[model samples]
Target chain A: MTTHPHMALVLSRICARFADEERHDLSVLRDVTFSVRTGSFVSIIGPSGAGKSTLMRVILGMMLPTSGEVVRNFSRPAMVFQNYALFPWLSALDNVAFGLRMSSVPKQERERVAREKLKEVGLLHLENHYPAQLSGGQRQRVGLARALAIQPDFLIMDEPFSNLDTITAEELKADLLKIWRAYGITILMVNHLIPDAIELSDQIILMGAHPGHVEKVVAIDLPRPRDTRGALFFQDVDALTEEIRKIS
Target chain B: MIRSVTHPQAGPWHRIHLMRHRRALILMTIVIGIAVLFGISGYFSGVAWPTLLEAVLRTTYRLALAYGIALVLGVTIALLVGWSPFIDFFFPFFDILQNIPSFALFPLFIYFFGFTDQMIILFATSSIVWPILFAVLTAIKGAHKDLNDAATIFGATGFRRVSFYLAPLALPAVLTGSIVGIAIGWEAIIGAEIIANIAGFGAFIKNVDISGIDASAVAGALAILVIVFVINRLVWAPLLLESSRRYAE
Candidate 1:
């Protein structure tokens, strides 16, 4: 790894709260503080309604925290939304080029970079197809290509593979790891799938919620291409599963 | 060497299939057949075709003018009402206005505009504006949240947002509303011309009634039918098809 001393992102005492229909206070996230190192792969995992999504939204600037600060070193970070928010009217190529064009990248360069990024995601052939014309897996690939084309120093994803079928999701996760290794991008991803989080992340932050809080942070010491059926893999899964159950 | 020229395969056969579903064509043919049958029977019965033709021409001109005025007023009002959130608070008031029979205002219009072409145009425009405005507002409000969010995220704010995202999404609804408005306009113009004795198809029918000339009245009605058919085929039908194709998911 290329040595970078500074942290890529920092969250200082972040808190997010919402009001219920009865007008009572509801805290989604409380006093959460963490920092992602440069070129680190971090996964946030929790059960349903555990503020995993809220954390992602707060980081993306989509939702403002009730209190605390989020600081970043990057100029513009790219996000892969949970729903794969590809513009319906735009074709795959145009969707991938959207942010570049917004930043006033010349048209030819934008297209060239978009094509190259899409080719990385194995979606170059679908350049002319609209979101509606593509399957769910294809649309997600385009979404990844869009985030990748920006060539951001940091990549943020929210349940990026939650919608895909099993086989496609596995293939995509492997592809993502390969790309992550090649680019050395700092990634913070949210996932509900334990195996996926374990397979891809260098560290997993396990969260729980009555009012959401981080329960544990586990570091994966295993090397790349960790086997799901291996003894160590099952042991880790079993321990994580028990911890998640206790929190619920 | 003698070569027989073969025409290149004319577009797709699906287009021919779509043409067969043209309701305007079918409606026109039915109307024309009825008109020709009536004319032939009237001619044999010694009804003067020249007088009938004159009355039909007068009626056609009146309907055309009234429809033109209605079109302008309806489209303008629809755009305004659809875009303004503050103005939308008065929609129920407009709804009440729509329920008021436009013919009920004929006496007031004649008293003010004095049975002139302007009076007829006023009546037609009043009849046309409400439905179009309501339809456009509904369409704008009903636009998908995802598309709106995407537009906002992409920095499609201000006038560009309205022109690009709002306008295209609202187009299909606008077309539907306009078609309904135009149909109402046709009914209003004819009724206003008849009641107010304006120089229009309705007035021609009134004159035919007073003179006891059944053939001329029939001919005037036929002319109105043909004109409406032509307008629907030439303008509204194509617009509806185009809007549906462009905006449909």
Candidate 2:
């Protein structure tokens, strides 16, 4: 019903339901409404059974909402998964070039572009390795590089750092911020990590379960390169933590 | 141009190539040496070397032709149905067809092609096609849903999906199915030849002198075994190794 300028995406009264055992309708998402501004970083954080992943699928157009409307002003969206979905049969370079290959780009051109992306991700040395041969951090980097190769207007991530070690996850988070700034791309991510959501997001959308719907949207007014150890950072984290606890 | 791929350090690719060539040469020498000994002895424990080799060549030709037909037919049918919406509906129908006795249908083949090589080859093809079809069909049906989603999201669609994603995904199954099909094909081809008295290794063995318990039959069996071993070593083993390494999830 309402609109905003430079809106990358606007979901209006979105609802999703699936058939459970006994063929009965089980609602997962209910009338979820939100708008993402272009080039802003947004995070959706919720507890278990809050339909976070289901909403992600709906947003990516991988699954249709049972009833609702999604208005998209941006095209060429890409997704990064928690499990890096690299093809086991392809080398890292080929994996990164997969989208270009599908677009019918010539082999030489795609490989050159893919190599540049790999170099950007600090993975030029491992371009010849298969996904199975790489460590988890390295594999996710390849996945990130693959998504980046398509020159997407928006990036969707579903718990991208949940599978890695603490150190690796932290490193990737900083790299992702740099990537986001450099590419000037919009990001929509879903996760249960409250502190992480506070640290990286321009806006954090909180959701409640039992037919998931938005609880609140909190805007981070802090300056760029937010200092997590500072007083204001922890205050925001504490307030968001309280909000999440109340809904969860 | 695409950059040439090479490991940072020196690899064993050259050494492995050299070893394979050496092994093949040694096996060839042994096979030829056996024929020479048979020729010089004027009559060895086996049949005359020339007749044995001739029969082998004939049978190999027939089997190769039959297998070629089976491969093309089986892969085509499986892929056509496997990726279709009607795959589940067609599966049971294919199952019933596969259960029919291949030998019982030989009279029908004989009627169509007479007692010629066509009849035997067709009969062999019938027996070989089942393993390949079922293997590929099951593989496509049982693949992880995520892989299909990934393929679609990355821009593989329509014919491109079939060619680039589905075909490569089903390759390991194809190799396994072909191996099984070849084994079945050999039995069908050899049996059909012996029964119909065709000009192949089977018939050659059937007509040889058996007063000394058939020297030529023993020789033909040994020769066939050697051929099967060499083919497996030179073709199937390497292919299998490569498939498992490259296609594994």
Which candidate leads the pack in TM-score?
2
Task: Give the chain B TM-score achieved by candidate 1.
Answer: 0.79
Which residue runs of candidate 1 sit more than 4 Å off their true CA positions?
Answer: A1-5, A17-28, A51-55, A104-106, A209-213, B1-32, B43-140, B184-249
lDDT of 2 by residue, B1-249 (tens): 898687532346446755876797788788778866865876555457797898888888888898899888988888878767799999999999999988889889999999998888889999989998999898889876656666777887777877877787778888899899999888888888888888888788777743444667767877897888778888887897678667655
Residue A235 alpha-carbon offset, candidate 1, angstroms: 3.2
lDDT of 1 by residue, B131-195 (tens): 76677767766666544554555444566556655665666766787778778877887788777
List chain B TM-scores, each candidate: 0.79, 0.82
Cα lDDT of model 2 by residue, A18-107, tens digit: 999899999999999999999999999887788987887788788999999988877788888788878787899999999899999999
Determine which window of 10 residues in candidate 2 chain B has minimal summed lDDT. B8-17
Q: Residues A72-96, candidate 1, lDDT per residue (tens digit)?
A: 7665577776677776656799888
Quality of candidate 1 docking, DockQ = 0.21
Q: Interface root-mean-square deviation for each candidate?
A: 3.6, 1.5
Show model 2 residue runs off by greater than 4 Å: A1-5, A20-26, A47-49, A207-216, A238-248, B1-46, B204-214
Error of 2 at A202 (Å): 2.1
